[model samples]
Target: MIQLYNVYKTYNNTPALVDISFIIKKGAFVFVTGPSGAGKSTLLKLLYRWENYDRGQVLVNGTNVGKIKFNRLWKLRRKIGVVFQDYKLLQRKTILENVAFVLEIVGADKKTIRFKAWEALKNVGLSHKKDAYPMELSGGEQQRVAIARALVNNPKILLADEPTGNLDPELASEILHLFEQANNEGTTVVFATHSQIILQEGNHAVITLKQGKIVDTRVVV
Candidate 1:
């Protein structure tokens, strides 16, 4: 579903990504693992269109991402769900409202919005915290809410960047399991993290990077 060919991204003549190329098939779970400043986040930014590459092609679901206009990019974004390590929730918005925001933007009816938001929260095991503000919840809870917000619309691909960085081992494991469950349900999952705790699951394709280049890539059976 996602392909990058000879991709090169530079800023102020300094390289962030250099000649990176890879293909992620539909219904697959993959990792973009790398150390700090290794362009892992830069790679994700390109996928989310936060930044554009200076050279090469990026295709998502057969559409050239580089050619997608801003207006059209919004539509493409609707098909993707992103979870950041920080959770990126609105401090003032209640948990329920946070998840409902997506539905509201897409013109979903109030009843459907509420139902879908609640279902997503339940999936993340945060049903009872629906009325609480983001600051009221613990870090793990906030991350779960973030996951719910990302999944509420049932996006085709879920992109997570260091999703478990701030949580304890147990919570991180739970979050990984949630990603696994989403993958099992056919939502293509692409995760970028340096956390070895998750690699033990041994059910994904891992692309290891060092200093902005792919050093090793292994597809697990």
Candidate 2:
């Protein structure tokens, strides 16, 4: 459902991605793995048009993302979800409102938004935290809130960047399992991380990058 062809991205004369090419099919759970400065995060940014390519094309579900108009880009983003290590929730909003933000932007009805948000929170095991503000939650709980927010919109693809970076191993494993569950339910999952524990999980299409180029591609069997 996602394809990148001869893509390149650069910043201040230094290349971040060099002529990268790859395809991710629908419903596939993939991991973009690499050491620091290997371009894993750069590639993820390009997927959502957060970073535009300096060369070549990025196609999402048959549409050239580079050519999508700004207004249309906003609409296109609704079809994809992103989870960041920082948890990006509104500090002042309750968990329910945070997850409901996505639906609100798309003009979903109040009843529908509340229902979907609650379901997503339940999926991430954060139902009881629904009325709590972000600052009142633990790190893992905050991250779960972020995940619930991302899933509430029922996106076709979910991109997570260092999702477990700040959590303990036990919490990290829990988050990984949450991602696995999302993949099982048909949301194409792409995660970027340098965690060794994540690399050992052994159930994903792994892509490794080195110095701005893809150095390895392996399907964990």
Candidate 3:
């Protein structure tokens, strides 16, 4: 569950988001689409409190993300998984360790960590490459590893920003399908992308933005 009420955010003297308001219910799959500089990244950052908002409220699972104390930020982040466009994998760590690192940070037991990490890799069709370092894999493989890392903890919410931007069409479709599977398994998903190819699957909410404002919101189905 995520809610934003009359949110406003500005950078320097320029505004990035203006009067944005919307609600995403639990288990919902939502897409945020817009042109370049439309504030899609800003919106996602606000949800995770990666960037401070000058005004308005952002509530994730009923807790105000912006108002949380610095000490408790991890408590909020642990429940949400984020996939940046860059993949952000640790080049030195093997894929399995990269995914397992999340569980380790959460202090999961060794057995549980190994099992969940393996399962996450299998979910992305990359269990065979679990021992490969990030640099040893192709672009798409690295992306899959990133997805495995993001989903390894079974997060309550998933935020992806241009996750498939650098992949080929088929690879992009494969990546998007992985996100759909994650959403179907009950993790709410909010993806931000400018790609129209993602619209081919039309059974979810789509929020269009322009100049940092919510220009439109519709259920694609």
Measured by lDDT, the strongest candidate is 3
lDDT of 2 at 116: 95
What overall lDDT, based on C-alpha atoms, would model 2 receive against the true structure? Answer: 0.91
Q: Tell me the lDDT of candidate 3.
A: 0.92
Least well predicted 10-residue stretch by lDDT in candidate 3: 195-204
TM-score of each: 0.98, 0.97, 0.97
- Clashing residue pairs for model 1: none
Candidate 3 TM-score to native: 0.97
Once fitted onto the true fold, the runs of candidate 2 whose alpha carbons sit more than 4 angstroms away are: none
Alpha carbon lDDT of each predicted model: 0.91, 0.91, 0.92
Estimate, for each residue in 1-221, the C-alpha lDDT of model 1 and write its tens digit.
99999999988988888888999999899988988889888998899798999999998888888888888888879889999999999988999999999889888999999999999999999999899999999999999999999999999999999999999989999999999999999999999999887876646899888877788998977
Model 1: lDDT of residue 81? 96
Clashing pairs in 2: none
Q: Kindly report which residue stretches of model 1 are placed more than 4 angstroms away from their true locations once superposed.
A: none
